[model samples]
Target: MDLNLRKAILSNVSGHNTEQLEATIVDAVQNGEEKMLPGLGVLFEMIWKEASEDEKQEMLETLEQSLQHNQVQ
Candidate 1:
C-alpha cells in the first residue's frame, strides 16, 4: 500500500481499544473483502518486523502448518 493510505488507516485505528481492534479484524476476515487485506497486511508486517526470532519462527511454523492443512482440505 502507498504511504498515504497506510497513514490514513493507522490514523483511523489509532484510538481503537483491543476489543475494537479484534472486532475489526474479525469482520475484515469474515467479509473476505479484498480492500481490507492491504490494511491488515500492513498491520501484520509492522508486528512481524518487531517480533523476536523465536516468535518469528513460531509464526512461520504455524503458517506452514496452516498452508499444509488448507492444501489437504
Candidate 2:
C-alpha cells in the first residue's frame, strides 16, 4: 500500500472506537478487494509484533487452516 493509503486507513481507524474498528475490518475483508489484503497484512503485522508466543502460535495455526480451507474450495 502507498503511504497515503496507509495514512488514510490509520486516520479512519483512529476515528473509530474498538467495535467500529472491528466492524470496519470485517466489512473490508468480506469485500475481498485485492488492496484490502495488503491492509490486512499490515494489521496482522501489527498484532503479531505485540503478541505473546502462544498467541502467535494460535494465529499462525488459524491462518494455516484458513489457507487450507481456501485452497480446497
Candidate 3:
C-alpha cells in the first residue's frame, strides 16, 4: 500500500479557519506528543510555501533567536 502522510495531514485540516488552525497548533504543542510532529511539519510547510521572501527571512531570524535563547535538555 502506498501512503502519503503529508497529503493525508493536509486533507484533514484543509477546511480549517484561522481560529481552528491556531487551536490545532496550540493543542499539539501543549500535548507535546511525538506523533503530532508530522502534522506540525505539514503546517509549517504550508506556511513556508506561502510566505514572501521578507516573511521567510523574518521567520528564519525568529527561529534562530529562539534556538539561541532556548536551552536544550
Ranking by TM-score: 3, 1, 2
lDDT for each residue of candidate 3 in 1-73, tens digit (9 for 90 to 100)? 9999999999999999999999999999999999999999999998999999999999999999999899697
TM-score of 3: 0.94
Instruction: Give each model a TM-score.
Output: 0.86, 0.75, 0.94
- How far in Å is the alpha carbon of 38 misplaced in model 1? 0.4
Residue 10 displacement in candidate 1 (angstroms): 0.8
Poorest stretch of ten by lDDT in candidate 2: 1-10
Q: For model 3, what is the alpha-carbon lDDT of residue 63?
A: 98
Model 3 residue pairs with clashes: none
Q: How many backbone clashes does candidate 2 have?
A: 0
Clash statistics: count for each candidate: 0, 0, 0
The candidate 1 region of ten consecutive residues with least summed lDDT is: 1-10
Per-residue lDDT tens digits for candidate 2, residues 1-73, read 3467656666666667889879878987899898787667666777899999999999989989999889964
Off by over 4 Å in 2: 1-5
Give lDDT tens digits, candidate 1, residues 10-51.
Answer: 887888999998998999999999999988987788789999
